[model samples]
Target: MHTPAPTAPAHARPRAVHWLTTAAATAAVIAGAALLQPAAATASPDTAAAAQARPAPDAQAATYPLECRGGAPRVVNRATGDLDGDGHLETVAVVRCDAGIGTPPSGVYVLTSPHRVVATLLDPGDGENVTEIAVAEGAVAATLLGYSSDAVARCCPDRMQKVKWQWRNGKFTRSATPDARGV
Candidate 1:
């Protein structure tokens, strides 16, 4: 005759099973704690310091190109034309400066050669803002918006003057009459 093997009650498991469950729970808790840590906490000291020293995207130090530092040269407007009449297109960049408070200084840079600044057409604080800039037919025109007189508020522009610079004799000159429609 055949005989059946003995078995434990359903409510009670083997001692080995209890130890296995406890080990799994402990591992899960450790994994959760590891995942909860901040990324900076895992970074090296040098990496953390570099991240802190980095400038904000909009900061003046970040805005200006490596070559130009004067006036903090934040390029607000740009145009391309044969500004020097060399049959090659030159760049005209209107930049704003970070000078103290109020309206920062502004200027225009003429790039006769590629990536090389040849001359500064306008200086900062000469006007409130460079409303528009364009180069056409060997002439560069800039619309300067600013107070007509000291009596007017610095924030308000009582006049809009159109200035023209013509490329001649290896340099640019201010023209008395500005082109009405600057290209």
Candidate 2:
């Protein structure tokens, strides 16, 4: 008879208490995670839309030397280098415009930031084409390939002009090299 108090018949209340405790802990953890979410992630869709409608800050908005037309300029070639020796990697992209049936307008653009085209390295006319572009020695070397004259058809370029672009006075200056070749 010292055998015992019968342990209260293994009360179901204890099991219920344990389940409630686990449920409360799980809810707390989930609530904490939602509160700690990033501002953008927690924002409502309308709030996000309103934020996007606001103008970009000046520090974030860079001014470009040239403007693209017809649509967002199409990037044909791209390279990366410290073009201005600023220790920051600058982007050199050869962009072309679909102006008309003739050779598309094209140019070399340098960007310190993605949203801005900081400099126009080489701008080819409506019928001119930029065949090749490269970045070296903090300078841009571009090959202007296009018809020799206005009479030449749009089949293939007949003349190849080599041009060098250098960064100077906070801008780009183009110089025609003597290596004009024929394709």
Best by TM-score: 2
Worst 10 residues of 2 by lDDT: 55-64
Global lDDT of each candidate: 0.66, 0.68
lDDT of 1 by residue, 50-115 (tens): 434532122222223323445455678777676664446667777776555666546777764336
Candidate 1 TM-score, C-alpha based: 0.53
| Local distance difference test, candidate 2 | 0.68
How do the residues 1-183 of candidate 2 rate in per-residue lDDT, one tens digit apiece? 578655555655578788999999999999999999877646445643543454322312334343556644457777766677655566777766545454466766677654566666666554567878877888888888777787877777788899888888987888889989888
lDDT of 1 at 127: 62
After superposing candidate 2 on the true structure, give the runs of residues whose Cα lies further than 4 Å from its correct spot.
1-72, 98-103, 124-126
Model 2 TM-score is: 0.55
Top lDDT hit: 2
